[model samples]
Every structure is written in C-alpha cells, then in structure tokens.
Target: MNQTDQLVDLKNLSPDALVDFLEGMGKEKFRADQILRWIYLRGVTDFSEMTDLAKSFREEISQRAIISFFTPETIEISSDGTRKFLFRLCDKRSVETVLIPMEGGRNTLCISTQVGCAMQCSFCLTGTFGLERNLTASEIVNQVCAVRKDYSVDNIVLMGMGEPLHNLENVVSALKILYASKGFDYGPRRVTLSTSGLVPEMLELGQRIKVNLAISLNATTDEVRDELMPVNRRYPLSELMQACRQFPLAPSQRITFEYILIRGVNDSQADAKRLVKLLHGIKAKVNLIPFNEHAGSAFQTPDENAIRAFQTYLLDRQIVAIRRAGKGLDISAACGQLKEKLENKLLGSGKESSLQGK
Candidate 1:
C-alpha cells in the first residue's frame, strides 16, 4: 500500500480485511474480532482504549491505522424528538443523517450513501445539488457508529441524501460489516435500503444482501413518474415492478413501497386504485408519506382527508397500507427536507423554515 493508503481507516475494513491486516503484521488473526467488537459494537474509536491488545501492538496499530469518522457539523433536534445530524466528510462535503425515535423505544437512523443525489426527483431537496460523490463504505458505516455513540440506534434506513443503488458496491460492503456478528451485529431485518427504482441494482441487492428493500414509488403512472422521478424514464414502472416480483425475498420478508402523497398529484382515488393494481403480485406494504415541503419546493402535502382516502382505498382492497406520520417536520428532518438549509446558504437566502403543516 502507498504511504497515504497505509493510513488505513480501520472502520473501513471488513472482518476478513482486518484479519488480513493482522496477519500481515505477524499478529494473530483472531484479534480482528476483538477489534471489531471494540470499534463497531462498542463504539470505541481509539485503538489505545482497546486495552485487550498488547501495549506495543496497540501502539503499532495507532501509528499504521486510523479510525476515521465524519465531523458532525450541525445537530438539530425537533420538538417531536427527531434529531438530524449534518456530517462534514474528509473532502469537506456534507451529508445528513436522521434519527427517528418511535413509540416502542425503537430508534431508526436514516443515513446517507452519497453526498448529494443524482436522481432529480422533482419533489426532493437533495436532488437539487445533483451528484456530488458516493460515500465510501467506511463513511457509510461511520454514520451508524457515530450515532450509536450518542443514541441507542436499533434500525438503519438508507433513505437519506442519495440513491443507495447508485453506489451499490460501497453500500453492499458496509452492509456486510453491519450484518456480521463480529461487527455491528445488526440483523438484516433491521436494516432497510430505499431506492428510487434502480431495477438492476435493486435485483442485485436482493441476491447479495438480505436487508429489507423499500422502493420510492411516488407516482402510479409512468408519465407522472417520469416527471417526478427522472429515473423512472430509464427504468419504467413495468420493468421495475417485474423485477420486484422476481426479487429473491427471504421467508416472511415483504418489500415496502413508499408512496409520497403530493397534493393534487398522486393522492387521488384513481391513483390509489392503480397503486393497488401495480403492487398486485408483489408481497409488499405501502408506506404513504405525505409530502414534506422544503424551501423553494413547489410540491404541497396532501390534505388529511386526501391522505386518509388514498390509504383507505388500499386498505379496502386488502392491501396493507400505512399513512406514515411526518417526523421532525419542525426540524425539516423528514423525507426530502434534509439539506435545504445548506442549499439556502449556497443560494444566499436567509429563509430557514422548512415545515409546512399537513
């Protein structure tokens, strides 16, 4: 490895890679598990604090390796107890991570896989920045480790700034470490990756990672989806649905279809019926997310009646449907509201509020 590369971020290496590094240093390979437990499960980032290792060995590791983590630039907490963390990466780029606390003491962390998104979904705020860069596997897992250092995180959702499938390899590698018993020890069922209908990579993810899959299916028709999510123009609804039907799902695992209910857009009775038909064969549940408006966005959240009617339509049709309550609306931490404040800074506008009451 080059001199720069030799300053390896130990958090970036997988269990096997850790073992390889130990073996190369003439140390026992089993020490990799000890390190993994300290760094991942225990949220210990300092090698010197891993007291189980010999003092000399720890010194050697401290010199050769680094536990890299993003610098938390800003942390905002809403009245509803949702916390949003904006992390500044090594390249000085920023990504947002959200912690949504549920009623049953479940804390689900929504982490970013990229700095900004390439998928220009008309309603999303992150799409405004276009593609910045894909986050490395270490950067991805670092969000979890960083968050766990403060909060007890039980679930993880790849529903932040970027489309995860757009950076498939890094995401998959991070998932391996997160799922491994020697690492984060998070079960596959607790980890969910949401996508904007990247069919090929979605299929590949199913075959490779056993984590839960959630697809952002905002619009029912291809014409509408083409306009809302430009990715739909490439992977149309028919092809995406077909791929979903064929996806290798583990026993009792059902795909989650996230339907954002935009006012006068995709929340009509007819749209609800079509959504049911579209998800006819797939073992899926619909999460009806009422649009969370941000600064400079034209979309409006559907009325409560409209949202209820749409969800009711699916429920009556015997399809499992849930109207997802907007979390951290006051803090702009809900879906698509992240990064609006940063964009405001870039645009030189002092307008800060992103909450538009439903």
Candidate 2:
C-alpha cells in the first residue's frame, strides 16, 4: 500500500490504533500514550527527544510511521499584533494561517482548509485564486499544532481561505483530533466554523458537533447575496434561515453573522434594517467587516460614517453588532487576502507556471 493509504494521520487515529500499531512493532501498548504525549503536548519534533522510549523502538517508529509538522515559509506581523504565516504543505502547495490577539486574554487563530477557494465570493481575493484541492485531515490539524507550538492562541476560527463545509469530512476529523484529550484538547466552545450558508452541511454539523457557528451573511436579500456570494444561488437566504433556526446552539451561544461592508454594494442603511428583520427572533451577533480591497476587486471599503450608521441601526433594534479590525494588509494576510506567492524560477527555466491562474 502507498504511504497515503497505509500511514494514517497520527492526529486522526484513535488511541486504540496507536496501541495496535505500537504492539505490532514489538513495543508495549503503553508506549503509544507516552509517544502521543510527546508529540501532542510537548510538541517534540525529534524522536531523539523522546528519551523515555527505547532507542530501538524510537528507531523502529521512525522507519514506519511518519510524524508530520508544518514549517512556515514566510511570517508577517501586522501593526495591530496580528501575525500571518504562509506554510508549505506536503504537496508543495502553500496555505496561510493567521493569529489575532484580542483583548481580555483571548487569541484567535484563523486556519485555512484549502490552498485556494472553490466558492467564488465576488469580493474575496482567495476566490480569485481559484480552486486547488481539499487539504487532508492531517494538513488541517498540522496547522493548529504548528501555530500552538509557535504561539499561545486561545481560540480557533475556520475562516481563512476556503469554505470549511466544502471540506466537511476532513474538517470534522481535524476538529476531532484537536478536541481529543490526548491531543490539543481544545474545548468545542472555543472553536467556531464559518460557512457561507451550506444548508445541508449546516444541519448535519448542528446535529453532530456543538461547536460555535458563524454564517457569512453579507447581504440581506437573495438578489444581493447571489451577486456577492454565488453559493447563495444554490442555497438561498430563506432556506439558510430555516437551517439556522434548527441549529442547536447552547443557551449562551449566539450565532455570529459576518457582514462585510462593501461601498455601493450592501452597506446601505436599508440593508442593515432588512438584516435586522431577517434575523428576527433568532439569537445572533453581527460582525461588520469593512471590505478589504485587493488588486482585482472592484469593491471598496465602506466609508467610516456609513459603517457607524449601520452599526447604530443594528444596535437601535437591540441586535448586537461589532466591527472587526485587525492586521494583514501589508503582507496580503488579512481576511480574504491570503494568496501564495509564486516564484519566477519556473518561468525562467522554461516551465509553465503551475500557479499561473490559481
């Protein structure tokens, strides 16, 4: 069998699988737990660091199963204390992850699930990059492990480059690994998955994992949403709201609706009023994100006065809304601004650029 099939993502495997694999290699079953602690908790990269394990056992493990980790190719620190990391994956494709430091001892890590996005949101830079492939469960988990190893982050948001629901299985598997007591052990409440209203997946995720949910509800009407986010064409606003009603949220948990304010698009006071009506009786929080302009995007960020007026409209109706401000513009690492830089070496060497359109 190939390595991809025979070698499981050590993060995805249950304790039983680890014990079985270790026993097959002539090591005691208890050694599995010891090695797991070393990898997950201590964040040890070298087998030599696992001194408690027998040297022969460590050598055998090195020869059999591979322990994966991500090395950041580029790191950018925003003026607002936010950090973005460009990590090179096993397939040589690159993805970006961001770390945001919030007030009150809260830190959020925004992770990407795909190299590029298939959901072509009109204003998103990532959508312009086009689709590549869904990352393996290991690739997703390695992102968290890598960020945690390097920095102390308190929360996780699946809101970087690609749509999390599109890569549902792998994303959930990665979440399980992160939630496992033997692994990262992050509380489900601290992790939030953002989707562009994939209704079927939303229903399934609501039933399966009780993690926090954030919906990218940038537009109040179907006409506007379909123009901004193409996914709205498949699953319209009505159906999405119905799914939200069925979503199982904890007593104190309120669904977060992400609204990106675009000039001359969906930033009008009427849009804000319509949004308030659409979310009536549903426990929700609105995150007003001023559009971050990119090279090819025709949209511009909403004026400061317009953004404040919209925030005031929502608050007047007792709807909670907060503006999201963070770092990333300088290095193209902000929300919807992560794209891997392609080198000119291939072009100079008479090779077609694999990352040309993507």
Candidate 3:
C-alpha cells in the first residue's frame, strides 16, 4: 500500500467531527472550519494552499491526512450540453456522474451513492452490474466537487448510478457536508436525494435532513412494483406509500415521485389514475420519464400519444406532472448503459465515436 492510501481522508469528516479531530491534534475548532472552507468552498487540495493555517499545523496534518478528489477518467459531452463523467475510484472501481443543463439558468448534476446498485430495478441499467460496494461519504461528495470545478452546478440530485437509501450512513454524512455552511453551502432546496423506496431509511432521512426527497416509484401496484424493483417485495407499496405520506416536507415543497413511463407496462391512463389515487393525501408531484431504451432491455419507451395521455390524466386531476425531456441519448448518458468497464470495454470494440471525452 502507498503512503497516501493509509492517510485519513479529510473529505470524509463532517464539520463537528472535523473540529473534534483537529482538537485531538492540538488545533483549534476554527482551524477545522478554515480547512473546510479551503477544501470545499475554495476547492483547494494542497495543505500549503490553506494560507490561514500555520506552517507547523499544515505540515503535521499533511503527513497524516489527505483531501482526495476523483479525477474523471473521461468526460463525454452531448450536443445538448449534457456532460457525463466516468470516474475511476481509488479501488480502481468506476462510477459515473451526469450534468444536465436546462434553460432559465438551471444546471442539475446527478451523482451516485454506490458504484453499482443492488436494488435491481428492471428498467434501470445501473442495477444490472449488481452491488460492487457502497461509496464512502468522500466518494459521494467528491463527484460534486470534481464537476463543480469545471461546470456551473446549482442543483444536485443523488440519482445517477445507485439507490441513495442503500448507503444510508455515508449518504447522510455526505448530505451534512453538502449543506454545511463552512463546506459546500448548498441550500436544502437545491439538493434532492432519490431512493428506491427504502422504507426505514426514508423515515430516518426525514428526521435528520431537510433536503428534497424523491422516490423512484415506477409503479402504482405492489405486483407491478415487485417485478420492476426488488425493493418493493421487501417494502411493499402499502408500507412505501405510508412512509411517503409520513415523509416530512416543507409547506412549499412536495415529494417528487419519479414514474418512468414504460410502454404498456405502466404508461396507461388507468395506471395514471391509480397513481393519483395512491398519492391522494400526500403532497406530491410526478416526474414522468419515458423509459430510455438501452441495449438488451425488454422495456420499450412509451409512444408519444400514450405518454401525453398519462400526463394529461394526472394534470386533469389537480396533480403536478411534467414530462422530462430526454437529453444526452447520443452518449448513452445513463451510467452502466454503454460499456461494462468504461475504459476497457469500448477500447476493444472501437465504439469510441459515440463517447467524446474532454
């Protein structure tokens, strides 16, 4: 093992924990805040760049700790201004992050919580790889840090590769850092975490954090959801809906239920009605995503008419619904959709034309 590999990752430490850590090292609490500001706010990596810290303190910590960031192995940019970053972690395992930009100055960055997902959602490509390992709090936070350095990311969604609720502890730690005034300084409204309806974690997250919560609820029935997402079998629709209703939200905020409209599977007007009834009492909005067809996927994207009808039914019933426009299709922008190992698989096949890296 290398020397840096054994060093403690400063990015993994939360604000209070960081202060406690510095105090144990014979440093002041304010110094921890300064280090956070320099690392997260100022994007400084080197200990020497922390000008406010004394030379002795900097040198001492530099020998025992490190601030690590994922230098993206490749960055693929679509014509529509959507950028996908394939990040290789310290373990040599890879993860992906996508940056989706919209008009009216909205830029949302999608980050992962795990390298691959265990949820095994039928339509999602990321889950096929199975669970590799849960990402550390540092790995999750570093995705935002790496992207923010190059692009303007105002909104963050924990929805790229894995189920956010699966890695609850690290995810919560990462959220604390993201919202810390001394750290990323992101407002609660500016960040959203999507989960595959992990019932227990949903309640825990509600009690702890104030960020927007999104449920990857692709179906209205327990039978359908079970086949679509394995998690539904464990925490059925009844439990999931109860948890959603109980999920605390600000008066102005609504829990976003992401319903991927798969043709003939869950895109019917009948299904739409079931969804409205299911979300009847809860403060909710629906993001209607037509399935993005990938290779070897049994699911097909809903026809334009069917998709419109589903959204119309919800809108007619006083439900907030919007059809998410597809972006970055050219690059197979969805993580785990293009290649098995991003760097190795494509190089052998010579399908590099689709992926333009920066």
lDDT of 2: 0.82
Q: lDDT tens string, model 2, 99-199?
A: 88888867899999887889898888778777788887778877888889878879999998889999988788778777767667788998999998899
How does each model score on lDDT?
Answer: 0.86, 0.82, 0.87
Cα displacement (angstroms), candidate 2, residue 233, comes to 0.8
What ranking of all candidate models by lDDT puts the best one first? 3, 1, 2
Error of 2 at 248 (Å): 0.9
Query: For model 1, where is the 10-residue window of minimal lDDT?
Result: 349-358
List pairs with backbone clashes in candidate 3: none
lDDT digits (tens) for residues 1-358 of candidate 3: 8897789898898887788888889887888879999999899999998988889888999998999987887887889989888887876677889999988878999898997788898887778878879999999999999998988889999988888888998998898899989888999999999999999999999998888999989998998999999999999999999999898888899999999999989988889989999998999999999888877698999899999999999999999998888888888875676435465466566655223342
TM-score of 2: 0.89
Model 1 has an lDDT value of 0.86
lDDT of 3 at 43: 94
TM-score-based ranking, best first? 3, 1, 2
